[model samples]
Target chain A: MLRSPDLVGKSQDSLREAFGKSLILLAEDYPSLVVLDADVAGGTGVHHFRKNFPDRFIQCGIAEQNMISVAAGMAETGLIPIVTTFAVFLLRAYEQVRLSVAYSQMNVKLVGSHCGLDVGPDGGSAQCLEDIAAFRAIPNMSVIVPASPIEINQATRFIIEHKGPIYMRSGRSPLEECLDNSYKFEFGKGKYLSRGSDLTIISCGVCTGRSIQVVKDLKELDINVELINMSTIKPIDQKIIIESAKRTSKVVTVEDHSIIGGLGSAVAEVLSEYHPTPLKRIGVKDTFGESGEPDELACKYGIDQVSIKNTIINWLKNETKG
Target chain B: MTKSVKSNVNYIRSLIVSSIYHAGSGHPGGCLSCVDIVDYLYRYHMSYSFLDCDNVSRDRFIMSKGHCVPTIYAVFCDMEYISLSELKTLRKINSRLQGHSHRVAFPQVEVSTGSLAQGFSFAIGESLGLKLQGYSNNVYAMIGDGELQEGQIWEGAMFAAHHNLGNLCTIVDYNKMQSDDLNENIIKLEPLQNKWESFGWNVFNIDGHNPNQIREVFSAAMSKENQKPSVVIAHTIKGKGVSYMESIPSWHGSVKLTEEDCRKALKDLECTDNEIEVLMSA
Candidate 1:
């Protein structure tokens, strides 16, 4: 349990620092634990783990394919391995992750750092906007997107305890702290950040904080908005999503990923399959993002909080007209 | 711990031929080539418990050359992990014996192997995982010479050596044949031993059919430290036992067997009356 001081306070760096520290601490408890890095230690924030556990940390030196196989072999020997790399490199070993870790059901943790278009000015190639959808399609995989540093730390702890394989998404930019340390975090449950009846906004990662802001802004306009932070994408909080679609009759899904297969698509899957509601999907629409500031990209792509607010208002007006 | 070395290679040849003939649709060429090498590992120098296959610390074996699943399956069945009756169902639908194996189908299987080159990586991860957990168990991964054409296999090879994975052992079944042709005509891994050695492995070359030589090298590998992962370059002949099939690329995978062909292959092994009865029953 974390304290209020630990709440909504730390940046992504701080969260990753804490995660590295916690990982080193966990090494003491489980000596079988080993950390692997694919040349993104400082970027992914696992430098601390490398520093503290030099003997256990395997630096695979820029080779993503080898890193994946080595990690798989390590897992086969009964050790719990945590791998860190950029989203693009992780995709290089997608087949390895799928066949070896997921299909074989080995215990391995893959931390996809600098996910989405949050790598600031790194541009499209460096930014991993499609990672969420790419990993979500892996069967028998636990997909997690932590909203803030607090949630990142929580997800870190959660993944270590949970059995099987996991793909944890980490933000390149520091996100606002949303949950206090005392907040109870579970793997598959959606956090109902605020409650409203008129409309529901579902989001996760940095976009979750943005969705909360949209809820606040909509409230000022007398539009009672319900905001849900969906942390787990696969085995998504379907109950809340369907319930929200049923109550609000209109749902706005937001994420810093492609609308085709990311959070918006996941939410839409539930709605189309069971609850058919009018949905406004907020994401990068079938196009790669350009080199710009994280905020600029979000605003330009119409995934910012303001865009979410405007879309919800328009959807409401449209419903009334219909 | 186990030290298994065969004094004679003839026994393995006989067994491999008999098994492939019985199964009818196995990768006989590759399986024959790998038989002596695998036999050496199982018989000579690995510390794995046959009874406690589920032991977390027990040594693990992975067949990266998944098309040759029948070979390993036969070896395991001979070792009594499975019954002979189950051996008859190789490649049959709704059978534990799939063309590739899954642990869900068999308890002794640590990892499911069907897709090529991935098994080596899986073995590497599992090996490191065991070592990280403070377990002394080792992992043995086998890859086909042809399967090395897959990019991921090289990735696994490089990683294992770079990490100085001392408890890991990888064996290459250099039968020199691919699915449709010889490895040289395809993608040649000629400086194969040099490549592995360059990537920081303790490479050993052996006559793959000679079980004793394989056992001795594996034993040496087990005792060494401060070295990279070890690879035994087992020089083998594809379709080792049958006179006509040996070193033939077409036998890589096929159902070329008829009753007459099966009888001829079986006759070469000098099957006993009791063994003949067993085969008939199966």
Candidate 2:
């Protein structure tokens, strides 16, 4: 079951909404679990957690660095703190994350909502395109991007149990379901959504959701695309990536983030190191996004299905010529 | 009690002087300035001693200005949290005592902080966490006056007061000098008391080096009847006891202390022959 039965009829739900619900649900089991926000409760969708657990929810006003710093302190007192904000703004405390959380190896979960182009009309400032690069660069920090609302639910629970520092991104735009309720989210593991031999499309975050549709559509056209959801960016699933790439021969990496230092780069690093394979990284090409509809931005930024299809089509033509 | 505090403070000063002087590089200027306040808290205020950390009903202390961690090691050694031999390994390779305090290296440090203002911010969170657990124990953090220039301090100032965290107390060692130069040249923090008051903290002004004043100020800050966060601004010279190092910007940190420097520093703190031998042992 690619899609959860509960979300079968539902057309769309934002990743942040599922993240907030998962946080509230996880709080019952882990009493030490607390949520900290930088006055972005509505944006990051933690207002429900704040409302339900007022004693546990700490509103740090508009100070992101303080929110991060304080969360590190909370972690020291045997409490698990999830610090939330828009992805781009999370970098404002990059130094704090480096020192207080990562360098110190504190048990703090950093959840950045509004990741990448899905941020839509809010533009480049709000869209957190560089968080994957920023967080994964730190030695002790793990980066996770959930493919859909179901993945977010599972990933949120996984992070609460996982100790040390982690950066998990949630989205503002509605994400279609990709994983069923039975799906278990594991750190540093990739999921094989569908299988084919023509070429592999390794995608992360919402791109994984879209790639599911692309692989299905391409199967009808006899292209036979292999789709793997590479959600965990840092400590990436190297085994799955190499195996899928070797079987398919050619690999296309897709993400809602930039081409540099993201899912594309992670896959490229793995393939280029151990298994040399022809690969194309499909994402925003070294440019800032602008104010537009998410669908328009997706097409302009070349992460849309039509753009990925055109790329795969060109690659197939090149293969025929070879 | 004041007389005992003065004597213990001098002993801790000798410990700091010997350790930093042996390490060849450490911040002694701000350490000397802030030692009395921190030393007083360890002796009279904080409930838990590092030697007896299993006691959960204890107050937490955060050293915000971490470069002066030699002073913390000195206090810990003087209080017997760690042995006098470990106190001599201030900046040694693989020593628990780092150039900047790290909790991993030394678990006695509640939070690892060399980056300014962030420790105070963490103190606010710890206070909130304790409140959530229904523990009335307080969280105390000390920041150098120059460290107050960091924006996160003010953010924490606003946050602690707004939440009415009466268990949270911040001691500002107003030694004035920063990394490169005096704070007046870097960032003027004039009307500093009014600034904290404006942020809604219960502000108390005191002389940082005076043992009696340090004790009296904390009593008012620690009073349970008050219902908001407290800030004790202890104004003092950058390097108080040492003659040449007093208010000298170059002695602020990482300045190698020669044999003569250690000898003179110990002499300045008025350490007797027996005290100097004990301080320099191992």
Candidate 1 residue lDDT tens string, A8-118: 226545445556655755667777677889778988777767776788888877778767766766665567789988888898888878877787677889988777777
RMSD of each: 3.8, 3.4
- What does the lDDT read for residue A16 in candidate 2? 88
Span of ten consecutive residues with least summed lDDT in model 1 chain A: A1-10
Residue A158 of model 1, lDDT score: 83
Best by lDDT: 2
Best DockQ goes to which candidate? 2
DockQ of all candidate complexes: 0.59, 0.69
Worst 10 residues of 2 chain A by lDDT: A1-10
How much RMSD separates candidate 1 from the native structure?
Answer: 3.8
Model 2 segments more than 4 A misplaced: A1-11, A319-322, B1-6, B52-56, B272-282
